[model samples]
Target chain A: AAGVIQSPRHLIKEKRETATLKCYPIPRHDTVYWYQQGPGQDPQFLISFYEKMQSDKGSIPDRFSAQQFSDYHSELNMSSLELGDSALYFCASSPRGSGRFGYTFGSGTRLTVV
Target chain B: QKEVEQDPGPLSVPEGAIVSLNCTYSNSAFQYFMWYRQYSRKGPELLMYTYSSGNKEDGRFTAQVDKSSKYISLFIRDSQPSDSATYLCAMSVPRNTGNQFYFGTGTSLTVIP
Candidate 1:
């Protein structure tokens, strides 16, 4: 089975720099979710999309924005980065768009802001 | 208060020991409960999931939900070192406003031989 795919397994950026992270959910899966996990903390929900439409939002910062394309893939764009933004970014997908069926996660992108 | 609470433990246990991990929640709308095991630097992997209340077992893992108490638990039997990982309890509502998943801080377990 194909799993969620996250690009740039590791990213490094300087404060005030900009970056873009990508996620390719499992084929045929229409829902995608983004989460940020800081060291020693649980994964925090950032935002989510269903069928190319933003369906929900979480603790995502104002400097960050995301959107799902018609292809069902999504991207997280961050600007004016800060050191606190350093963490592992995860993307999850569910076929039904509800996590009740269990969501599949990607390996994650480790972003380090210096 | 937080919607869900769990002990953030690097709870260590000897090999083959039975282990219990738990979480409590404040939301009554949460009907779908799930447990995920995450290895260091890896994505969380679903261990077991249960709906409403009662118990569900798969192999050496069992998931239990007490809807009346708003609490849930995961028990691992005859554990192995391979079982060492962070266990996170998560829940969601399947009806109104069901797109979000609430998670626990996770309890880290290390099974030693």
Candidate 2:
């Protein structure tokens, strides 16, 4: 089965720079969720989308924005990045109405801000 | 208090031993419970999932839910070194709009050979 796919397995950036991460959810999955996990910490919910529409927001920073395209893929754009933004970013997808157990996560992108 | 609580244990045990991991939640509305195993620097991989209450077993893994106590557990029998990883417990409430997952602080386990 096809799993969620995340781009740029590893990313390096300097403070104040901008970066964009993309995600390709599993085929037919209509919900996409983004999470950020710092070292030794649990994954923190960033934001989520359902069917190309904004559905929920969590602890995402003002400098970051995301959107789900018509293709069901999503992108997370971060501007004026800070050192604290360095962490593992994960994208998960689930088929609508399949319940919570349907969530399938990607390999994740490791962001390193210096 | 946090929505979910789990002991962040760097627990070590010999292979073939039974390993138990647990989590407690304050929300009574959470209906779906899940267990994920995350290797270092990797995304979480679902290990077990259960709805409502009772027990569900698969291979060497078992998941138990106690709705009345607001607690959940995952037991790995005959553990192996390959089972060493961080275990995260998550729960969610079904919603028409979207569902948000609450995760507990992961427990790091190491099974020695």
Best-performing candidate as measured by lDDT: 2
lDDT of 1 at B16: 95
Model 1 residue runs over 4 Å out of place are B94-98
> What CAPRI grade goes to candidate 1?
medium
Interface RMSD in Å per candidate, to 1 decimal?
1.7, 1.3
Off by over 4 Å in 2: none
* Cα lDDT, model 2, residue B102: 91
Which 10 residues in a row give candidate 1 chain B its minimum summed lDDT?
Answer: B91-100
Worst 10 residues of 2 chain A by lDDT: A95-104
DockQ for each model: 0.64, 0.71
Residue B48, candidate 1: Cα error in Å is 1.0
Q: What are the per-residue Cα lDDT tens digits for candidate 2 across B5-110? A: 9999989999999999999999999989999999997889988888968999999999999999999999999999999999999999867677779999899999
Model 2, residue B1: C-alpha shift (Å): 1.5
Considering only chain B, report the TM-score of each candidate against the true chain B.
0.95, 0.98
Which lDDT tens digits does candidate 1 get at residues A1-114? Answer: 899999999999999999999999999999899999999788899998888988888999999999999999999999999999999999999886456757999999999999
lDDT per residue as tens, model 2, A1-114:
888999999999999999999999999999999999999888999999998998989999999999999999999999999999999999999888774774888999999999
Model 2 chain B: worst 10 consecutive residues (lDDT sum): B91-100
